[model samples]
Target: MTGKLRCAVVGTGHLGRWHADKYAALPDCELVGVVDVDQEAGRAVADKHNVPLYDDHLAIIGEVDAVSIAAPTSLHYRIARDFLSAGVHVLVEKPITTTLAEADELIELAARHGARLQVGHLERFNAALMDLDLQNQPPRFIECHRLAPFKPRATDVSVVLDLMIHDIDIILSLVDETPERIDAKGVPVLTGDTDIANARLQFPGGCVANVTASRVSMKMERKMRLFLPNGYVSVDFQNRVLTRHQPGEREMFPGIPEIVSEESVFEDGDALMAEIRDFVACIREGRRPLVDGQAGRRALATAIQISEQLSA
Candidate 1:
């Protein structure tokens, strides 16, 4: 922990390139290398950072202190396993893996090897959500809508995993309990996989969340609304705006209290960099990350359940 932590990025695709950018920009971290099946894509990122490019993730295992695994969802398990087993810290992207067993194995392996495993639930570091305390004012009902135009690059998976998983992680964190019932429906449009979906989750804690995700929409939107015991909150993830409605001391009527509204626009910032910084800090400080392997597993488990319901 005294010197800079040598880091490598696996799978130099869309998000993986940004991972390399942050690792190189951070003062306490050194961008050691990058990996990809497409050598041209991988070399572009590695060359930008002046680091070597490897054809396989395992090629850089022993040389790196940590790695950011942005490989394809199916390959997440294999690459993360080798790195964790070698005692190298890992910051893997969303969903952790395609199956619960794979996620569990990664969690267990990280523990056994004493290596830190963090998931790229990047929204956790959003400026708008930074000061929102979910524990103190737990929500009774939640609503989320995430929409994006169809892109062939991300059609490998359903919209549930590609987009909705972000809100799933956030909602699960706020509810802090397993859902007692899950009602879901989805259908394919542009691709064979589900392009639009909705899931209504009823938690054991008397909380309900209605989540929807669409990849065939004409316009992009990311928003969430929460109904609290004494107030309401609206988070515009796309614009980084947080709005709250609560009761004021003054009354609008003889027996009713007046409603007070407040809104704040947070600076649109780089959540990816913040996520990587936390990953490095967790490795150095010997603490669990905000979105550790267990947390990611929980989100993935719930997502898989929802996906199953859709298929049924």
Candidate 2:
């Protein structure tokens, strides 16, 4: 709240290492420590970031005002529960936890402890996504495709949790309504878990989102197309570009044209850094986080439905 907020990066694996670097480089945050089950890897990240390393999170939980939980999906609930119980604000990575019950418990824990819980839906911080004027109206229909080549690093969970959950969170945020029904299906291609998946979410507000994510694609692509009453918005995550097709006025065309295209490229910014900044800002200002626990729960609930359907 004062000079600099102390922060720790937990689960110093691939993603957590980057989280540690961001905290270390943030002007208003002091990187207190990096915690990981792998002591050597944790120490390496700490050394690189010039922060202390701890194999156990308990040692540093009392010291940091806020922490980023970038650990595996399986460990999210336990680690975050412990930190939040200690009154430490947490920024947890997506799919919040393996089960919806776990997510609910974490949300309750944060509320009970008066600690802020922010989910790591980093796309919300993307400059391209942030520029969208989603204030007045929610999306009517959405399509998302997040495809990537297989990487052995994040195989602990299914592609739904590993990748599709990102789009699920984004769609839920845009729609802002409870999904009435979700018809989903997926297949395991490369790993033991489902690799490529698709879900059609029907929201009570009549907004439908057709989401697909695959980790076995030959070419990498992360894009979403939003269709609203007034216009269509297309976002390219990898390219940092947002294009809109809105109806043009009489000056631009004889009558109102069916659509007029406008393209814009966002200034290159680090989304992960922005996400961490938001977490620190919320912790400092006592302002509610953009992707709060409720938002995360919505996404997680949708994902759980998809997974259940897939399993069935």
Candidate 3:
């Protein structure tokens, strides 16, 4: 915990390369190695960071204190299990794994081995949400939309797992209870799987969420609106802006309260770097992460419900 912690990044793809960059730049971590079955991709990242490169994750199991598993969703469970079994802390990418059973097994492995298991829900570290506190003020209704143009890189899963799950995770974090009812609809466009989908979730405590995600959209947007008891909150993820509207003392008309509005534009920052920094800090301090394996499993459970409903 005192000396620089040794760290490595597995699957040096697009996002994995970024993880390597952060570990190389962090003073508290020494970039131990980068791994990828694709020799060209892994070597590129490793040479760029001046670190060792490996084709398999097992080679660095005993050498690293922590690792970032940015491999494909299908391989998440296997890679994470191996690392956790070796007592190496892990930061696995979103959707946790292909199934809830896999997620549960990984979580149990981390506990059994006494290692930290964090999920890469990168949006949780966004600056736009830094001031928003949903703990004390739960919203009665929530609306979310995440849209992006078609990209072949992430077509391995449906839009529900690829995009919608981010918002699903955020909403689940806001409300501790799982949804009591789920209604969903989706269709296949470019990919054999559903490229666009929408789900309506009703929680046990009367909270409701309507979420829509599309990978075939013409434009990109990431936004969420919350209707609280005393105020309205809006988060523009693309622009990093948080806007709130609350009732004021001065009335605009008889029996009507004036609405005071405030908007905050956050500075452009790197959310991935913040996520990595937190992972390292949690490993050093021996504490639970913001998005632990349990949270990831919760998100995956809800997403699976929506996906199954859509297909049925």
In terms of lDDT, the best-performing candidate is 3
Q: lDDT at 275 for candidate 3?
A: 96
Q: What's each prediction's TM-score?
A: 0.98, 0.95, 0.98
Q: Per model, how many backbone clashes are there?
A: 0, 0, 0
- Model 3: clashing residue pairs? none
Model 2: lDDT equals 0.88
Worst 10 residues of 1 by lDDT: 126-135
lDDT of 1 at 282: 94
| CA-lDDT, candidates in order | 0.91, 0.88, 0.93
> For candidate 1, lDDT tens digit of each residue in 56-80?
7878878999999998898899999
lDDT of 3 by residue, 1-312 (tens): 799999999999989999999998999899999999999999999899888899989999889999999999999999999999999999999989999889999999999999999999988888887678654887899999999999988789999999999999999998888999999999999989999999999999999999999999999999999999889999988888999999999999999999999999987767899899899999989999999999999999999999999888
Candidate 3: residue 90 lDDT (0-100): 95
Per-candidate RMSD, Å: 1.1, 1.8, 1.0
Candidate 3: worst-modelled 10 consecutive residues by lDDT? 129-138
Q: Rank the candidates by TM-score, best first.
A: 3, 1, 2
